[model samples]
Target chain A: MSSPDDKRRTIRDVAKAAGVSISTASNALNGIGRTNAETREKVKRVADELGFRPNALARGLLTKRSHAIGMLTNDTYGRLTLPMAAGVSEILVDHGVSLFLCATNNDPRLAKLHLDALLDRQVDGIIFTATRIDLEPPPELLKLGIPVIYAFAQGPADSVSFHPDDAQGARIAVQHLHTLGRSRILHITGEQNYLAARIRADAYRELAGPSGQVMFGEWSEEWGHSAIDTVYSQSGPKPDAIFCGSDEIARGVIDALRDRGVSIPDDVAVVGFDNWEVVSKQTRPPLTTIDMELKELGHRAGLAILGLSRREKLEPGIVRLPCSLVARGSA
Target chain B: MSSPDDKRRTIRDVAKAAGVSISTASNALNGIGRTNAETREKVKRVADELGFRPNALARGLLTKRSHAIGMLTNDTYGRLTLPMAAGVSEILVDHGVSLFLCATNNDPRLAKLHLDALLDRQVDGIIFTATRIDLEPPPELLKLGIPVIYAFAQGPADSVSFHPDDAQGARIAVQHLHTLGRSRILHITGEQNYLAARIRADAYRELAGPSGQVMFGEWSEEWGHSAIDTVYSQSGPKPDAIFCGSDEIARGVIDALRDRGVSIPDDVAVVGFDNWEVVSKQTRPPLTTIDMELKELGHRAGLAILGLSRREKLEPGIVRLPCSLVARGSA
Candidate 1:
């Protein structure tokens, strides 16, 4: 193992070893300027032998490209940010770009501090992300000269952003139940104040027409269990299918139905949103849920940001990525 | 809003505005060399007035301190790594240092690629983390000239590493059960091959003496549910308390016990490991579990890395952080 005192090989050493001027050595290695082809090859070979890796800091200074990007997020638990970050890293790493993740934890002061640090570091671009799409990023983000992209968060009207199509996802769930030959469908969702819940409820209402029943409650398994009692206690007719806003809620619904001695998909079929593996896969019969595809949204945003970093002209608008249904045992 | 075409204020500009030599201005702002206190204050005032932020890349070229660190992890799911990374960021950000996260996805080749990128960027240090402590990081990690600290992962014998004390955590759970006057205790855990499972089982055996029973199975809710049947179907004294290896297992055990008309803390008490809020809180009566304090381990690792970066003397060895029991209605 090399000691901390071991000095890294520098371009100067490579130049001396290759018997060329410093400028010629640099141009040859970079494959630019008016360096002769033969000299370039010789210098490159010498550099390879000497194990000369160009310092990113030095190279960034000359080219004005840091080859680094900053990701500012308010998702403290990483429920949404981590997968998105993984997708971003998947693309950025191949392009020799490193990502810096700054968790603001919803503190505007902390967010501003992190932003300043990123700007001072001369990051090529910045991607703002959050747990939900309704929240807007700091206004100062738009004023920054460098490129900016919003992922899983709302941005200004003239900015580029990506989020899942919640309404479309709701439609897919309702359609799946419809195809399964179920007419009475009930929507059990999270708090009405949440934009996602409102959007999903609206879509379900549109499809269910006048017969659709919507219940707004907490996004918890407890809520799902109680919702069953509230719906079944009524004398009219027990819904043949139930669409839950989240996997947690669906798990509860499935458990409640089982406790009541009702057979799943026969007495009542259950559909869920957010294909969270832990919750969706562990349910008694597993849950058929909607996947927001946050990772894919992040991948597209990464590519767009990379293009913008290279000064490519990109249209400014909101791009709603499609969500997919993960069919399991329940529905 | 500043346009991309607008030029950034440089040190030279600040120096000219302050009516001082560039070298003097640089020295004064940096608080070094023979610059007088009066000149230092004047230069700083002038720089601030010009909205001048020092370019970190240029500063790093001279000081060899990039004010950045890289974190390499194989935790693709981010279940464990995310909380640890958050703790790391919490400490490092306060010290004006930025963190770069490189996910290797357990691929050796990918790990090498990320390592090389971090080195090229001149990151002051690196932190290696993973989902488990038994797994060793790439051997190349030790050979890097920069300081490296292992968090939630094993390091070489003479290197620094941090992990939760599993045996201690198990003992705490068993002791809590004993305090509740539950003499007949059973330990139901995941696969025995896992170091954590074995250590925890060993601790339980030590505490329960001759009559302690342990069942090794998959780390899933299914195992917990079936293990109950396996235990009850036999003509033997049923355990009064169950210590689970994970929250999922505990949830399943609780559910099965409830289905069999068992009253929690009245007929049987359940304690779980890994204070995973989702599973622990959602359980019928909530769960009392052991918290590994993974985030605190990350926080301490971050502090240690910073100390190493500043050339502070730190002892190298394995540090086992204590796990605390989270009390709830279950036990």
Candidate 2:
């Protein structure tokens, strides 16, 4: 019996067993150029009998395509990146592509080093993801010939990018609340710095009209709690519904409302954004929120890059994917 | 002016400029075999100026070392695996090692395919992580010569494995509660099927003698809320301190207690496990809980694999990393 430590069978072993030259055996096994059908079959049979496995690196060197993707990101928490990566992987795997993950931590030098290293490895393409929106990918990455797709963030003006339709997501939430007869809707949101926060706030203003109460603060539960106090302290009537920037803020609003003897949905229907499962599902009465469909965005990005790799021309512009409302107990 | 599509400088370009043979230029650039010092310096200077990047796959084939690792995980949510991966990447990057990430999703065939692909790519070693602990790696992996380290899971009897010391973590939680002068400490945890749940329950019984209360159900927040009702319905004395199996459970307990007008850290103190930042920090009063030290476990696991890759002998057994206590407002 062969021991487990025995060296793996090599192509040379197949060649010797088949009584053929190394070049003939290699050509027959790889189906490179034309060869006799009988000889090719015999070489393949010999290789299978010996359990010979071809070296991917050698094949990649010869073909100039590694069939691997370099997935670069600064999102260490994997909040959006994880699902996005899963979608990308789902598409890429079916195409026989593997992903090499690297975190740049927003460090320019580290990003350059990683980019160079990945380029040296001859990856077929690259997918760049970020925690926040950016105007463009680093200039160094644009020069590389490999296909590049930016997901959950913007890239250069000439590059293709994917992101959620934040304005549309806000509209869906407001429409849902409106359908439930919640007119006096207060908009409580995070800081004005984030593009997402501003976009959603603008959407709320357009959809909920000029009289809608809009407050911007930190993206925290504490902010959500305090915003309620600020609203109630005002001279006008209290809100019958609240559209929060995030599930965290919504949780705080619900808790504060509950503490003040206000019943969820009956007294003040609440809606949140991001539909984060942990926070949205665990809240008392649960939470109805906007789902960004990040995975779908990533899946489209994967397909786009695969197309680019095949020399197919692609439109260079932002593709804003549609968002959906996940209705739960609260709203 | 250069367009974005410009090709990167190649070794042949460097050699042509340096007035030397390609073989000599390559030997000088890579510091391989014997080469004259003057020619080496000239080639290095020319190569740097041209930005000649070497092909890593070619170098790997020559050296028989890829300087890359395959990280195979089935943890799709990235709750534990992400932190572990970050730790692994930290060490690997410092040593000029790249990571190849693959999610097998508990499919034996998929796992085998990934393993073969990684091997074909000439990865130096492999790290296997899982959604839960298991007795051994897949039988297909056992035959490979590459070093394999199991993290947050178990491997074969003679292989190295790393996991959190669940029993010790429970001891820490119980001891902390005891230090707070809590006599009637109630333990509310998740399902009885989980190894972690069972280990913590056993530890609670040992440390609390015969008087401690232990309840097991779902790992959901709803379960925590209902368990409180069950406890108070037939109880002699209500628990002064509650130790929850997870932050979600603790959050429910805190919310329910607050609704009943129970002052946190005054009428009752609460502690939790997992120290999940989002849940723990967002509680009415932040939770004081046990942290599994997962990142550190991952860092150590990375180092262990690095050593193993270098053929250094390692102690073959489960290395139970100690968990730590993170104190906040609740306790």
Candidate 3:
């Protein structure tokens, strides 16, 4: 249904229709340069009548600001990137900024290629994001001479980055169980190699004191189901509460507890992390979990990058945004 | 670590280093206008040495091609968009094209705003995508004087659109079960209002014949679990296999069957649609599911849009890409 290219109106047409020179029309439309108030209003009215939209590319060439940014991410699955991107786009769209999302999928060569493409487009700024906070972006990003920020991803020590406060997320999960009068809290989590798992376990240990039990395994429901067996098999006081590292693990714990005829929040309260709706809400008794607030992290990252693009002075360091707990049926 | 902007190399620097005029250097580097082979080589060498990347905006003014495309999507959770985006990006990145993803969250005003932003940027093409294929894109998109394509989304009757062959996906799922010696197959699916669910049910009826049973319910694990009780409670001859409309429902069915002490594959084989890894792979005994091949659809859509941008003659119509079955432990 689109019209022919020749049918599309241009600024030249607006200028001719307004009985003004091209420069005068441009100035009036842009509200730049000295122009008579009557002439400026006349040109604007004519442009509006013609439904003329200014070309951002042409404006960018003159202003040296593209009003566009690029997001370099390694999160191909979009588990983290999606929410973060939603948050970033939410903020940037209001500012009339467009975002280019380039997924590298952890391939170094691909990352470099995407980075170069973004540079060729002359994006005002770039945000590097990934699945985990431990993963680092390409080192070349620092030397691009443009504003750069990290969201839910690691960067150089001095670079501006945003991350979820995993320690606090864990503390709250354990504290919630304690508040419910559950003392013997057990931490069922993922691999020790994961920084999140370690951070959460450390926080759980702090809250649960000497009676704390930490079971490290894969981030899976099967592991959660099996860990419950390992705990109940031991000749000791059974845990009154279980805080899982992920929603999947919590689902598994709930299923395993039901299989063993244990009542949820009655015999053992269950809590999870990442607040993944699909798994958390699907659980028999919906999971009480910690939300990483990835979107908020992205929002902050977007603002910081915009600030840097505007040459605003900002202290460079990692900023850990707070995580919030979503109370559900299980805890 | 980035150097000052004044230190950034430009075409002028390359021209000065190569001892040629700016236009000559540009022509040589772009391989556009006729330039002596030796001068072209010299300009290229100097440009490479100086790390002078050409500004796409400046080149776009002459070429009228931005080498950038925009993707307008309504898939907020990214359940469908992520894989599709990966496919689109996979094809575009190789073509040196950057993709701008704008999330509208189904708000008409937001969609219009993002659409305007894409148009203002002079993007070479636009792709409209959404979670469901039955939903229509904004009517204004059809009026834009540019090549537009739809991926995993619906557009005008004659527009170029790519969608998963739901009937084919369902047939394959059912055929796979039949091939496994499963007879009296039961089809448990989501809401009947969904075109996907209806199409899949029709396909199931075709393969399953008169004995085919269809259970319409919500697309959730709870539904799958409860549907099983409903089926067994009144059933005379239990089904040998169950074909679910989604992975979540299949997971619920598998869990409920396990609770009922029904031996999988031995008593009841189950097949699920939407090879969603989180649910299919995590289900007890895993799950054999049909993949929508959304990424492949994206790849084809990218290629089609690129072809249209190049003014290549392409037949405008809906193209239903095929689906494939992923074999796992459940079936």
Candidate 4:
């Protein structure tokens, strides 16, 4: 626990301790300029002894690499981007990199403004993220000379993209329910417009076969509660398990079922997608949901961009990360 | 809409249009070196006509002012900080100032690392934010020379601090419930250890008087659900209105009431604090809650730091911004 009064070891401190010029110390540390090997080794040793850390700014000026990344996002609510941002920051900070986060609010003009600003600041590279997946990068971002990595979203066909595997997440949820001896399962999810909803539904159908029921509605708790009526009204046997597209919908379903005198995981088991902690963890029986590994996606995105910045070879195209089931009390 | 192909006007463009050397144009625009008044005026006109935006990086080299600020927070989830971040960005972007965001994740070592990094980057100022209120800045941030502003949290006694008025928010929630002609009101909130919970509870007592029942518990939906049992078990008349500390608790309360066949508004109206959109707006009846105006606090913090950077006079104390009621179906 170093006190605030404990001044950080600066290049000046290292120079003073090594009895050398600041530039000599800096050149010695960075392996540039005309410094002798013996002097460089001595400077390095002194720097290490004093815990002297070179300022990235001074290093960046010589290398033309700011070691800072611009993270452009349009996720205003930060529902998806926050975790991704956290994950990206988690890895980048260790490399003496900082993040410049910009929210474009999905406006092309705003996006361009942010892009230009970040470029003017001379960020090492850019990582563009979104709340949902897209097939291509924005038209303006296509020609950027700097490296770009898309996380929780897609970029151009040839660009590196990272996103959650919704199909696998759906499979995990359904398989978990099946292992619990629940055969009559119903899939109630968000609107059909979302690619995630469709992918999850497709996976559910393939795994559950003809007996599975799939209903698409808005991603709202109200819809989740109302869908219960439609499920019970069908002529066939009532579903013994329900898989919701989102935690919000799952919460609604759980509450509505409980209100009807049905015991969770006793009369029926329910599972959800996007194991959102605030909602999933607070549910009556808590929620057994799919963890999208968004943070991990972010972590990979950070590493991929760093690699690209160093001109390291990387595979392009969409890279779907795995999703797994988070077992809680509900299932 | 302007196409992405339309490149932003540069100083070179202005110089060419004004028929002056690049050095002369730079001197005139920045008001540096030897430049005649007529030439400076001519350059200014040409620059204005061309919509020339000065390169901050270039200007930074001479003035040592990057016009950049670092926003450091420990709120990894970004639940409270996102809106504040958005608000800060909203104000600072217009001034051509960019933000460097770092999440410390409540690690003192990480906090020190981030602070040192930001300082090394030569940021003009720093804004320290947190998930909860603190009486002072972290021990590591005490001695930084650059301007520092606190948002959604407090810093040193002499620094400008901006935070939500929890007491005012509680007053507004209580007053709204009272105006609805609901006398038997109960305050069900989170743990008493939280400063927010205590302030809000104090305000509730003053506004609702001695009769106002206050129950302190965990900040969870489960607590909200279980509190209903405690309230109903009492011999006296049931509460006609419930004011919750957070929207999560309100959602639980609303759901529990609905399950018990108690009609919302007609039987018991509910109000909540922190008008969290995802939780409040998605509630069954939609929660009427106290809007803490956290974004506004962030905006103010940004402005205060900008002002301080310019050596402008500002009062040093905890500035509590007023909270307002957001009327919805719940109350």
Candidate 5:
């Protein structure tokens, strides 16, 4: 192994060794050039073998970018967004960008304070984990014209976002039961106004084929109980399967149903969304849910934001990542 | 409505209102014996009426503190710790302290860099969120000798920490089951070396009486299922109830049981821990688990670390907060 004690190699050394200009060597190393593939590969290999790691600051200076992605989150309670932020960070780290994370917890003046904290740090791009954009983003964020993407959910207004395919996710739930030859499916989901609920509701109607059983409320266990209770009210051939909008709702649906002497699968199979192990794996009946792949969302958001300026046109819009099923006993 | 044009009122304005020197007014506000209680109350009431809030920055300068706390999270991938950090932030926010937050993404090298960043910005105190103390804290962080409390689990060495009362938490589970007139309860848990698992095991052994079943393994749904299977293999009157180490394991156990068409509560009641809505509320049977209230842990850690110094010859070594049983249908 090359020792740190050995003559430390710089990008200049690599450029000299490869008989190329410093900028050309940097462009090759960073994959930002129109050089021939052979030349790029040869220079890269030599740079790696010589341990010629370019000075990030110098590269940033030349590129006129920080290569630092900002993650805006709630303060003090930054924990809720930490995992999601970590996912974004992991993706950016591999791309050689540092994560500039900021939180606004103490004061909920909405995004005003937190947004300021992030922008002041001059991050190249931003990823927000909140379900909605809470405050009117200072026009400065848009005027600065940085590439921003909302992960998990969309921010307010016309900000382009990357969201899980919710309707498709619900379709998978319906299909899983359909494949098992189960009809009479009941949909238990979060509040009506949420975009997730709207999309999933549309999917249930599409798959359940008219007379679809749709129940809506908050993403809480109590909502699950209440929704199930309402479903049980009309006792004419109750649903044989249930599609829960989230794992939380599914858990409540199962529990409330079980309490009513309804057996899961035998009487009604169940499926959930969001593969949070603490909820699904710990529940009495392991739920088959959709994996939103949050980490992947962060990774893509990082890459997308970092590469925002690559195309000099405003092509920002929704980038829907696919959702997949994680089958367990309940479904 | 209050005018947006109004400048935020401050202590100097309050002192001016009471026609007192800044020192005399500060003594009154802080009750440092330079002013009588009656004078203090009068001055406070006047300050309130004028909406004069203490200028925390200016005051912190006087106090040689920031009236702000820094949080350095060693790892963010572990979703369980998020609540702990959130709780701390929530509590600190209520107490009116700005929290400077950063995550290490579980990289010690990055953690050091963050420490340097926080130090460069001059944070008053730090709450290091971790399951263990950092073996090698940044040299400057150590040099700053600012108070730091390792919240969530025990510190790596003999540093201060705040964790849920796992021993008492386990006892609560056993006692809850016992109250249900079910004595044949099995204890399923995680790695014995983890501080929480060890304390929980001790509590189970001591408070569970002789017939209670006890077992340990990694905290996962797979382990929960295997543990239950092992207990049933013994055959002699299968356990009427099971106390799971975590919500994940409980979900697995319940899934396996449901797959076998076993009944819950009627045939076997199951209880789990960590009432994480992210996971627990989404499970089938909506697991009956312990609410560790991690948000409160973060809050306490914020205060403990900032209010009392680790190097100062004061304060407690460890603080074990209470955990509560969030009763749900699985049990």
Candidate 6:
């Protein structure tokens, strides 16, 4: 007599009926597994009677695929890695692959120590999100032979990756301003050595007609402030709109502009990259920036790794995902 | 003949020079550990000539401590956990402890699986970052009796904890608005079921003086937009300032206000929590916020757990950290 909604069954309800941990229930139902046959059968029997349809991951595991993804970021970039990893996790979770995440502190000494830990546990594939793609990955990391994809920053290795299409995102910004009848765009950026910054600066110039100016600096509010001061002192029709490389740089520009009583959008339209929510939310005018779909990158990485794990012909090389223009009041 | 800095010392560097991992070198350095004494002596002689300072972790493991902290995070709030765990790991690394970090999808079943994995490896202590506090931990888990520290959120079992002082943070927001000559202020929030939200809402009312207004609802941008709409329509005086419960709500309120041509600061000053860099950097006017200092929180939890492992009286109960204000253009 009860509605279907009233009879909804959970892993817990099934676990209690089968006398096991929720993990056991999960393992039994989705068995690329590490659980006993008896436990799996008992849990499966309960799940069947409850009219439960197991998640895709459980189903994938039975075929020896585990349908799971492994994610790794070193502890050094702790602040940025979590959200990036979270975005990756959500994408994989939706695609029915469980994500096994691990973090290390960028201690080169512990490189193999921590990564091998994830490999030993047998994640179908791996995603390495690095803060600084500063060095070549250890040769041993290559030994695992699982599909390992790098995100956010690319590494010195020949693994697959789906990075933020910084070049495309920058070109979009430059083109947006040109379409709006604005000229003399300025490029503000982080350190010159950064891989993404280099691509973005190149794009800004190629797209900013003939007279666009570019400034290079570190990723800091102070750098942004310094860039604004540099722009203010220049002797020319001040660049109509500043195409900031990162939101941090944009804030510096916006703050300096406000301090000098310069009206935003009206006086100097600003477009920033990296739709980083934490930094973006606090701005005076909600900023219009580029949305780098990191989760999608994670999904692509997961799929690539899964494909590689099956000894399938993995499409070799890079995957650069498209970045979206998020128009807010700033541009 | 070399200066002390250039001088070659011995102990483990020779082992490191042999191209094996540091832990392997560590095993070689301590003749009493698992390695063959010949390997240990060879490593020791190489270390002596190479003048390698034995890594504290390598040295420390010899005298009854693994110098490792095992962290388990519920996948539900992994966004928060990732940064917190990273913060803790960095702190532990600084203290010469390697972090054994694992993500448990907040399922008790998986938690037990990971817990057993960590325990068998004999981590010094554990730090748990979770969302919910009501679920009972496994009896075997409870019986393990390792020192556990809960961060950002609580657990049902008795343990040590450290969380931001949300009450004080809310009070600071209200007090800041009071000084800004704003009388009618509104509170936009997340669901009441969250302990953090409830504490913040209660704090808002207590701090907002008698003439202020409080609006409680879900913690989404949509809720902020709708709540602001409701306040603007039937409200007693329009809220002069909006004290959003989270960064997400603040972003929505700002968007809603701007679409209606309402200016920030000149209209409604805004404040948010979590100081997520994403929102702060992307928004036009950077959000003025209270930095939850997640990394610092992790540091404390790591230290607390380590202290507990030594059978030291880790004062059982919550440790509330002070939140610092990050001033930006929004307010």
Docking class of 5: incorrect
Retained true contacts (fraction), each candidate: 0.79, 0.64, 0.79, 0.51, 0.17, 0.07
Task: Flag clash pairs in model 3.
Answer: none
**Number of the candidate with higher DockQ, 2 or 3:** 3
What fraction of the genuine interface contacts, i.e. the true contacts, does candidate 4 reproduce?
0.51
lDDT (CA) per prediction: 0.91, 0.85, 0.90, 0.86, 0.69, 0.69
Query: Where's the lowest-lDDT run of ten residues in candidate 3 chain B?
Result: B1-10
TM-score winner between candidates 1 and 4: 1
Worst 10 residues of 6 chain B by lDDT: B54-63
By descending DockQ, how would the candidates be arranged? 1, 3, 2, 4, 5, 6
Q: Which residue pairs overlap in candidate 2's backbone?
A: none
Ranking by TM-score: 3, 1, 2, 4, 5, 6
Q: Pick by lDDT: which candidate is best? A: 1
RMSD (Å) of each candidate, 1 decimal: 1.7, 2.6, 1.6, 4.0, 10.3, 10.9
On residues A65-112, what C-alpha lDDT tens digit does candidate 1 reach at each position?
A: 999999999877777888889889878998999999999988888898
TM-score of 2: 0.93
Per-residue lDDT of model 3, residues A1-331, tens digit only? 4445435568998999999999999999878999999999999999999889888888887788899999998877888888888789989999999999998988889899999988888799999998877765788887778888988888897789888999999999988998999998889999999887898899889889998889899999899999988877889688899999999999889999999999998999999999899899899889999999988888999999899999997898888899999999999
DockQ for candidate 4, C-alpha atoms: 0.45
Which of the two, 2 or 6, has more lDDT?
A: 2
Those runs of model 1 whose alpha carbons end farther than 4 Å from true positions after fitting are A1-5, A34-36, B1-5
- lDDT of candidate model 6 versus the reference: 0.69
How high is the lDDT of residue A7 in model 5?
A: 46
Report lDDT (Cα) of residue B33, candidate 2. Answer: 80
Show where candidate 4 strays beyond 4 Å: A1-19, A31-58, A135-137, B1-20, B28-56
DockQ of predicted model 3: 0.73
Q: Give me the TM-scores of chain B across the candidates.
A: 0.95, 0.90, 0.97, 0.89, 0.77, 0.81
